[model samples]
Target: MLWPFGTTWRPMRQKIRGTVDLRWLTARSWTTKWYPQGIDLGTWRGRRTLAVSWFRQDRMRRHVASRIAFVDLERSRHLDVALAIEGDDGELVPAQIHAGGLAWFGDRLFVAATGQGIWEFDLAALRRVRGPIARRLAGSRGRGWRAVALVAVRTRVHPVALRCSYLGRVFDDAGEPLRRVLIGEYRADENGRIGEFVVPGGPDDRFERVDLYTPGIANMQGAVRWGDHHLVSQSDEQRAGVLWSGHRDSLSRDRIPLPIGCEDLALDLEARLLWSLGEHPWRRVVRGIPFAQLGFDA
Candidate 1:
C-alpha cells in the first residue's frame, strides 16, 4: 500500500454560414495569469492546475522541453503538458499507470507502483512503454516487491535509485520469505547497467517491523532528490506528517507543521521551493514550503 498523492475550461465559438467556421473561447478565458505567491497553485483552483514536475531542472531536456506531469491515483494515470510553471498551456499528454512515486533518470520517467514495482515512461513517446518488475528485489522475504516511494538520489558514493517498500513480508530471488518490509537502496552506474542492492533492515530484522512503525511513525509515501539527500514524506494516519532528510546516513528528520498529511514531495533546486502532495482529496500539489527551512538546499 503506497500513499501520498489531483482541470479545465472552454471558450465561446462563432459559426460561419454553410461549413460553419467557429471561433472558440474568449481571450480572457484563454488567458493565464500566474499569481506571484503560491495561492493559485493548489487544488483550490479545482480544475485549473494541481502539481508541477520536479524534473524541470534535470539535464535531460534536449529534444523536448520539460513538462509538469500530474499523476492521478484513482484515475490510474498521469498528464504531461508543455509547461505549467508558465501556466497550463500546451499539448496534454496522458499516460496509463498507478503512479506512486515519480523521478526522472535521464530521459525516462520512473513512477513507483504500490507493491507492483517501478514503471518507466518514455518522454519522447510520452507514454508508459515498460514497467520492469523487479519480482525479487533486494532484501525481500518473499512477498514479491512493492515500491511505495522512489527517488534518484545523487549521493557522494553513487547515483542510486532509493526506494521504500510497503510489503509486510520480504522475499528473495527464489521467493523465500526473509523479513517484513525492506528499505532498499539499488544503484546503477552512469552507463545504466544493473548494480547492487543494499537492504538496511533497521539494525535488526527481528525488531524491524515494530521499530519502523510506532505511534507517531508513518510510511514513506513521497520522496524527492533534494541536494545530496533524499527528502522523504511520511504520513501518519492520525497526525499531520513527517519528513525525513538523509543520504546514506540519517542526517535528520522533522515534522511538518501543518495538520494536512503530505504524500509525494517535489523539490525544485532551481526554484528553491519544496512542494508536498497531500493525501486523499489531493491538495497543495503546487504551493511550496521553503527549501532552506526544510534543509533540502544550500
Candidate 2:
C-alpha cells in the first residue's frame, strides 16, 4: 500500500523529556469537552512558561471554540487563560475558534485560529476576570474565574485560502530572530500547504513564502523549518503519530514514531530541545525531545 507522502518510518532515535501530565485537570466537564491541540514554550515575567491550546467540543464532540492553558513549570501549576477579542462595545468577548496551534514570539502568542486566521495575544496583557467564560475550564472550584488574554491583532486569512493548523518561528543563519512565523495547514489532500509570514510587520509584507507538498502528509498537525530541513508532525487517530524530517526538494526524508495524538512543534534552540504535546482524550502531555537526537548539530 502506498503512503500518502511516500514517506518511510524509521526506528525511534530519541527519548522524550520533560513530560508534564495534563490528565490531572479532568475535573468538571472540562476534559470531556475540550481536548489539547497545540503547545509552545516561552518566558513569562522571568519564569519559564509552557502554553497549550485546547479546542472545546460540545456534547456531540463538535468543535465549539478554544482556550489556552498557561503552565508554570517551576510551580507545577496550570492556569486556564480564556481567549477573547474586543467587541464593538469595547467589551472583551470570547474568540470562538479552534486554537489549533500556538507559537510564542517574545510576549506575543501566535494562535492558529483555523478557518479564521492567525490571532495574536499579548502575554503582558493577561488580566484576571470573573464570568462564565472564564470559569468554564478553570479545573478548580476555588477560582470563580480565570485569566483572559486579549487579542492584540489578527492577520486574517480567507478560510479557503489557508486554514492554519500550526505555527513555528524562523530564525536567521546565526539563529537570530527573524520576526517571522511559519504557518501550516492540516489538509489531507495532495496539495497541502505551509507558509512563512512576517509577524508585527507591514500589511504587504505578511506572506514571505508558501510551499505545497505534492504528496502531502495527511493530517499534518505541526511544522517548523530550521535552516534547510523542515520538521513536521502528522497524526492518524487510529495509531501513533509521526515526526518527519525533510528538505525543500523532498528528495530525502525520515520519520520517527511519536506518541498517539502528537499535535504541535516548538523549538528551544538555546536548550536544544524540540517540544510537542499529545492531544488524545484522557491521555495528554507536554514533552520535549533533544535536538541532538533529532540530528541537529546546532
Candidate 3:
C-alpha cells in the first residue's frame, strides 16, 4: 500500500473525542518521574478498560523501571500498578525494563520490555495495596500513590532482542487462527522497523513465525492498521508529530499533523476511534481521535 506521489498533504488539527489525564502530577511527588510509553483498550473483570504503560525516569532521564495505569471507563477511576517479577526465593521484585508498549488479550497483558523482550502479566492477579505497607513488605518503592501491582508470570524473549519501543496487535481479515503482535523499533535518524510475531497459545510455547518489515519512516513511535493503510506516528521528542498514512509496503505517504509528545497507537473499530497517548509530563493524556478525522472513510 502506497500513497501516490504528488498527492496533496494538508495540515489539519486532529479532533479529540475523549481524553483522561494520568492524574499523578498534583496527586503525588513521583508524578513527573514516570513517563507514558504504550496504551491498549480491553475488558478486565467484566469492565471496559484502558491501560497505559509508563517508565520511571532517573536523574539522567533514562528509563529504569516501569508501571502501568489501569482506567475503568465506566467508573472514570484509575489505578496505578507496578510490574514485578518473582525472585529466587518466591519474593516479588520489580521488573526492570522500559514498559514501552502494551497489548491486552484475554486475561493476559503483554508489555514491550525494550531489549528484554515481551513480558506477559496476569490481569486476574491484579490486587490492591496500600502504598506505605507495600513499600516495606514487597520492596515496591517510588510508586508514588499507586494502589496496585501485577507480577509477570512469563516473558517471551525475542530472538534478536530488537528495541521494542512500541507494540500493536495485528487485525487480519483472513481470520487465521494465529494471533500476532506487531512490534515497533524507534530510530532517530534512520527508518524504523516493524515485526509481526505469532503469540503462543500456552506458557510452554514460544513466539513463532516471526516476520519483519520496514515501514521506511524514521522516528516512528507507533503504528496501527486501517483497511490496507498503515497509520504511523513519527515524533521528535517534545515537538509536534506527523501521522503517516500509506500502504504497508510503500515508502510514499501523506503526512497528517498530530499534537506534541505522541507515543503509541491503538485502534478501536467498534467505537471508530484511534487511541493515542502523550509522553511528556504535565501534557500527558490518553486521547481518542475519530476515524473520520484521520482521513479514513466512515
On residues 1-298, what C-alpha lDDT tens digit does candidate 3 reach at each position? 1112221212212333343233333422226666778888888567777788877766787755567767666555565566766657865556667777888887788888877777788766654444653452233355655533333344445443567788886665432223677788988856678877777787678667466788777888887664456677787677877777767787454454555788888777666667777776666666777667766655
Clashing residue pairs, candidate 3?
Answer: 1-247
Error of 1 at 237 (Å): 2.1
How does each model score on TM-score? Answer: 0.39, 0.78, 0.80
Global lDDT of each candidate: 0.32, 0.65, 0.66
Tell me the spans in candidate 3 whose CA falls farther than 4 Å from its real position.
Answer: 1-30, 62-64, 127-133, 136-161, 174-178, 251-256
Local accuracy of candidate 1 as per-residue lDDT tens digits, 1-298:
1222212222224332321112212322122211000111222113222233322111332212123434332232234332211115632322222234444433333443333344333433322111221111111123433422122111111112334221112223333333322222212221211112222333231222222211122355544332234455566654666776665245357743422444555444434555554432222223356656664446
Candidate 3 matches the true fold with a TM-score of 0.80
Q: Which candidate would rank higher by TM-score, 1 or 3?
A: 3
Question: Quick one: RMSD of model 1?
Answer: 19.9
| Candidate 2 overall lDDT versus native | 0.65
- lDDT over C-alpha atoms for residue 215 of model 2: 34
Instruction: Give Cα distance to truth, residue 283, candidate 2, Å.
Output: 2.1
Candidate 3 overall lDDT versus native: 0.66
lDDT (tens digit, per residue) of candidate 2 on 1-298: 1112332211212233433233334442235666788888788667787787887666776665567776666655565566766557766656667888888877667788887777777666665545554443332234443432222323233232477877876666566656776788888764667777666554344454544453366788887777766788888785777888867457233455666778998777777777777876655656677666676775
> What local lDDT score does residue 236 receive in model 2, on the 0 to 100 scale?
76
